[model samples]
Target: MPSTEITDDTFIRRYADDIAYVAQQPPATDLATLAAQLDTVAPRYEAAGITGHEDLETASLHLDEALRATGTDRDAFLRRAHNLLRPLVADMTQEYRLAAGD
Candidate 1:
């Protein structure tokens, strides 16, 4: 049977880790793979009304470009990526709590 309860919290936590890991140690190649991984989480954000989908898409492109260009700016890229993701996570957490009346 399909689960009725929303698992936004679980997704938020897991995706945050994924984002952090990617930002910290992005793959040597196949950046699209990373973006595709991120895409998996988009629906959860949309469901929670948390914006930044476009930002993630844009970031994915830039991150891939940056990784390919210098290959040594992972720190900077991580900072930018985390900056974009952190607020979305926070907002989603808040929305989930509010919806749950917690």
Candidate 2:
């Protein structure tokens, strides 16, 4: 994803890389299981309407708590970060597509 006026290019690139890394990370602990465990995290977004990137860290925090409750803490942070990045990839890709006048 490319940078926008609100954030730097390096940050966006790092986010992308981190997302990929988290997706690939071996979950030695259940805290890292984003997919199966997100059921617990989904409610926080439901209450807040899951708007934008501004909510990522906050949402991640909630997810971390949920993971900790599930008996693992290793990958909670990265898992949340990965969840945050998925939407960003879509949003940024669409922005680039629109810029291309598609």
Which numbered prediction scores highest in lDDT against the true structure?
Answer: 1
In the range 1-102, model 1's lDDT, one tens digit per residue, is 953331224333435544534244443234445556565545555675666666776556555654555434654554465466656645654565575466
Q: Which residue segments of model 1 deviate by more than 4 Å?
A: 1-34, 71-74, 93-102
How far does residue 74 in candidate 1 sit from its true spot (Å)?
Answer: 4.2
Show how many residue pairs clash in every candidate, following the order shown. Answer: 0, 0
Cα TM-score per model: 0.44, 0.29
Provide the lowest-lDDT 10-residue window in model 2.
3-12
The residue-by-residue lDDT of candidate 2 on 39-92, one tens digit each, is: 332343334344453545454565456545543343444445555655653554
Collision count of model 1: 0
Instruction: State the lDDT at 88 in candidate 1.
Output: 66
